[model samples]
Target: MAYRKVHQIIQSHSSADGDGVRIQRVHGFDNPHFSPFLMIDELKSVSPDDYVGGFPPHPHRGIETLTYMLSGHFQHKDHMGNVGELRDGGAQWMSAGNGVIHSEMPMMTDGQLHGFQIWINLPAVKKKDPAQYHDFQTEVIAEKTLPDHSLVRVIAGDLTIKGDTVTGPLQQTGVPLTVADWRTQGAANISACLNPEYQTMVYVYKGTITIGGKHIEQGQLALLSEGEGLAMAASDAAGVLLLSGTPINEPVVHYGPFVMNSMDEINQAIEDYQNGTLV
Candidate 1:
């Protein structure tokens, strides 16, 4: 396995959306090569007027979305007839195997609204599978206290440290995918062991992080080559999103919202969605 230096650093930008909601896109709509992991959006608001109203109906296909809430409350409804609410520290994971229509809106009583939405890609073989949904409350996720008392949330994989294992919701995706969330109080340093065969990356969400002697600030993403995991140290109180998965080495053909291995596949996906055959 080879280790490569951080290649790019870009700040997330804000964009206006449905019902006065503001979304800061961290990735996607730009880089198309980040297979497996596609996009991330950080949404925030404080005033009731700014966040009480939220996103309405939308459509998705050939992707999986993970929504993590830091504060306030939001509810999701889908065409498949599924509905759920997410509060502080809650997460909603939806697999849009072939196609699905859904909507998410913030429900505010009197607090701020802040959260993130991350997109993951499915392998070609599973792109046509049925859609599914899973919601994890704050208490359902695995949390571990580090040696320095920092808290780490295991969202979807395993992390081993000093003979102790921290596990998250285990889902079999046919392809290997690992994702986790970490929060540090004050200053702390921690390292995660990773499989040498998997491609990995980290996204800074709240504060600053130094990896391989390079500092990354909030909203910037770092792509890492296959190798020994990552060594991260927080300069202040911070939070980070860690993701790793088996690389889809095949050629990628993406258009609008669909990702396929070839142009023919892309055309077929579009036709299926239009013909009401993709679901």
Candidate 2:
């Protein structure tokens, strides 16, 4: 086992959406080959005015999307006749197996809207499965508090804290990928010894962190490689999300929002979407 340091750091900023949404792409744009994990985007809004209208209905395919809300509320509707609302600390995991049209809008309320959307690529075989949705309220998520009061929420995968497996919305996948949201305070440090066989990355939401003596601030993304574990310490209170997964070694044929193994597959997806066969 080897200890690997953060390989890259990039800051996020607001785009042209006129909304207060800032995106920090941890691994998608730079390293396209990081399989199982396609994209990571952090959205932060101070008030409803900043993100009221929300993202309109859109289509997705060949991916599983995880939406974790830290604060505020969101209502979602999909073409599958599914509708749900999530408050603070809630999450939604949707598998856009074949295709799905959905939209997420912030409820008209008082405070802010903050959350993260992580895109995980599907294996070649599972890409054509029927679309599905899973929603988990904050209370339903498994949480573990460390001796120092650091809290961790297991979103996907097995997490053992102090010799006990913390339970949450667990998704069992043969491909080997996991995501956890961690919040800590004081001079606390939380470390995880990840399997070197998998690739890992971390995105900071608030506060600052020191990894391998390098400091990463809010809105920054860190990509790690060739490591057994990650040693991270917070200078002040902080929140971060850690994602790890095994790489899919197959050829990735990606076009726009659809990902497949071959050009013909991409064409088929397009034709299906156009022919109303994919919903």
Candidate 3:
């Protein structure tokens, strides 16, 4: 019956990556205590110049990237001959297990571009496996509207809003991870639950939400302590992302887009790329 408390609030900072795409980023790569979840980037822009450059072909290994588009369009192509179109509310999951080279280009659309791309660390055992990719439309991701007018979308795990529960489509994604988008249409209270051992974080991107009697505003991410209960109340319309995952608790040595358990592995990845054998 214990409610989790916000241990610390990390403010997202402005950063540019992938061919000059502007973003608000929150990273925890240096701290393994936030294992499994390496980084979260909010790709939002009104000017085409902000996101038009897009992500060019790049190599990655020993990690996973999940790109979820809230309101934008992106075309993805990989060395494996995989082609995908990431549309509004759609998502694409890529695992650079052994290695993979991919490019993501923006497709001009009618409105402002906005989305989130999350980087997850792969465990040592799964690092050597074959690369994998999956691109899905928005309808495939479980979406529900609560009686309170709050919206919920389950992307990677079971979620319960109010009293309704829904399971996500991605079941066995190597790492134990949970990701959901929750939003309130107006003044309302929200409640949810998750495993006590899992590390959890909530990022507010719209309006303001109150947790543990503390107000969290846009561009702020709150790290929570061990507990199963999540409670939030918003006086107005608000939107937030919920992320939870079991800690990997392993040594993490990351280099650029490659993440490994040791520096030797990182060096090998660089060598592989230099030799054009990364893919």
Candidate 4:
């Protein structure tokens, strides 16, 4: 019956990346508090100018990028000879182990592009593994509808609610984590059991929601205290992302798009990228 409490609330800030694409970013910035999770970004815009530029080809190493789209479409092409499409209600996972060069571009000219991109840290053991990429369609993701008309989409982990358990499709996500999109159509409360050892947090992207009686507004990331479960309440329609994962206790040295265990490794990554062996 123990519920988690809000430990801290960090507001997302506007940051431009990928050829002038404006995005709201929840930065981790080598902070130990956000261990295993490096960053979370929300790209929500109806204007073509806001997102049309898209993400150009870039190299990443020692990390994984998990992208979920609520609307619009994204075409992904990578140097690994992989091409994928992320449509509305779909998701993609790309593990830049060793290294990989890729780009994500919008397929529409005028429409809503609402989505999230989360960066996860790869442990030292898996940091040098071969690169992997997978695209999940709308139907592959597990979804649950509550009696109160609330909807839940499991993106990367297991979700337990009222004795019902739903496991997501990404079983080998390089780490243990839980990510879900919770949309409440009306005033309702959703509480679910979670692993006490996992560091749990929630990101509110639409309307407002309360975690353990503390109000979390839009674009806010609420870090939660260690507990057996999470209790969140919303007054009306709201959209939130539930994130929980096991902490990776290791040195996180980040340099641009590359993350490593030490500065020397970071330098090596840079050298490799410059030498055109990044892929």
Best by lDDT: 4
* lDDT string, candidate 3, 186-250, tens digits: 98877887878789888898999988988889999888888888998889999899888888888
Task: Please provide, for model 4 over 172-257, each residue's C-alpha lDDT reduced to its tens digit, 9 standing for 90 to 100.
Answer: 88789999999998797888999888888889999899987799999999988988988889999999999899999999888889
Give the CA lDDT, 0 to 100, for residue 275 in model 1: 82
Q: Provide the global lDDT of candidate 1 against the true structure.
A: 0.76
Write candidate 1's Cα lDDT for 1-279 as tens digits.
243446566677877666777778766433544656777778877776765567787666777888888787879998899999988988888888878878888865356788888877777787778888878899988888998878888777677555577888746553677778888988998777776766677888889988878888987888775575567889789988887777665565667667666788778878877887766
Clash-forming residue pairs, model 2: none
Candidate 2: misplaced stretches above 4 Å? Answer: 16-33, 108-110
- Pairwise TM-score winner, candidates 2 and 3: 3
lDDT for 79 in candidate 4 is 88
Please identify which of the two predictions, 2 or 4, would achieve the higher lDDT against the true structure.
4
What is the lDDT for 268 in model 3?
A: 96
Q: Count the backbone clashes (under 3 Å) in each candidate.
A: 0, 0, 0, 0
- Model 3, residue 215: displacement in angstroms? 1.8
Q: Clash pairs of candidate 1?
A: none
In candidate 2, where is summed lDDT lowest over 10 consecutive residues?
A: 16-25
TM-score of each: 0.88, 0.89, 0.97, 0.98
